[model samples]
Target: MFELLGIPPQVLFGQLLLGLINGAFYATLSLGLALIFGLLNIINFTHGAQYMMGAFVAYLLLNLLGIGYWPSLFLAPILVGLVGIVLEKTMLSRLYKLDHLYGLLLTFGLALLIEGAFRQMYGVSGLPYPIPDVLKGGQNLGFMFLPNYRAWVVVASLLICFATWFLIERTKLGSYLRAATENPALVQAFGINVPRMITLTYGFGVALAGFAGVLAAPIYSVNPLMGSNLIVVVFAVVVIGGMGSILGAILTGFGLGLVEGLTKVFYPEASNTVIFIIMAIVLVLKPAGLFGRAR
Candidate 1:
């Protein structure tokens, strides 16, 4: 087996695969944040809690209702997304005219409250979610074995990310969303329901988070704190990609995942911090982020 940089091929490739998997999750999660901030102009702090809710929903569907993975994958997101829509209509809608800090504080409080409720109910232990029967195995690829589920994650995340980008950048409804964000009064005058669109956009963005959580349930132990643990890193990814850059989030996510993966191989001590180091460098050099436009 050929070695790269004197490291065993299996070890290097294995870590890279793991990194890609991590990146998939990062990309999926950050994409949601970008959409919410970009279109709705509200920083959703409850996003992580929403994500945790998705996983718990899936678990409940499986254990309580005897629903399996496939149905839960679609259903969990919708249920959680509807909750987001309600929150938007009742709470987040009120904060749009306020400073960004207000939106941030409100959502942040919501996140803490939601997480605390889940903790009180479930405690801190992780609940196991079984991988679906169809996606249970792995394939040997000479240098490394690839798990079917993880590969599905990467492919699925990429598809969802790209689809979202296309919808926002290339489609008519997406055009209305972008336009409404820029000038809601003008868009509303054009006979478009700006408030409704904003509400739907927030719901859709949150749905993306829920979708990621479903993908994550089997891989990570589903716990109340799961989303909290990953969210800080995902936020770091959003900052590095730019506050509202959708494409930036996707590319930077996968790129950082690879970088973090390789870091683990070359220098395990710095693996956890490499993304932040890169974030610091990016902040210093290009404050708008790699793909974000200067405001």
Candidate 2:
């Protein structure tokens, strides 16, 4: 087998693939965070809870209604997005004029409420979600065994991330969203329903989290506590990526995941802390993040 830097190609590629899979989740979650922060100026602490809710919702659909993975992929996000819209209209709207910290506190409370309710019902044990029949196998790519579903996830996430980036950064509706984020009053004066837009944007961001949960359901055991573990690292990803740039969030997410994977290969002890360490270094070197603009 070919070798690079004293490592076999197989090992290197395999780790890289795993890194990309992890990156897909990080990118999706961070993209949602970036969108919410950009529009609402609030860190959505309930995001992880929403993600957990998505997996649970899928499980419910399967058990009660006989819905499968493919359907849940669409339905879970819609249901979760609706929940987000309700939260925004009923609770989050009231916090708009207050300090951003108020929004954070409100969402943090909401996260606890959500997680607590689920824990009460489901407990902390993980539930298995069967992979769809079609995507349940792996392919030999000569150098490594690549799982079909994993490859699909990486491609789908990249497409979704770039599509979101293009929509927000290139389209007219995106222009309105950006404008509303900058100055809602002015956007409202221009005949835009700024409040409604904010609500939908929040829903959309939450929906992205839901979509990720669906993708993750088959890969990891579904548990009330799964999102809790992942969200902290994702938050660090957001901080390192910077809040102002959507692309920055996507890039940082994938980059950090790969770095973490590499660390696992070379220095197993540092895998968990590598991302945070990188965040500290980034803060010291460029407080605005790699792709972030100094504000």
Question: What residue pairs clash in candidate 1, if any at all?
Answer: none
Clashing pairs in 2: none
TM-scores for the candidates: 0.97, 0.97
The local distance difference test score of each candidate is 0.90, 0.91
Runs off by more than 4 Å, candidate 1: none
lDDT of 1 at 262: 97
Candidate 1 weakest ten by summed lDDT: 239-248
Which candidate comes out best when scored by TM-score? 1
Tens digit of per-residue lDDT, candidate 1, span 81-188: 999999999999998887889989999999999999999999999999999999999999988989999999899899989999999989999889888877889999
Candidate 1 lands at a TM-score of 0.97
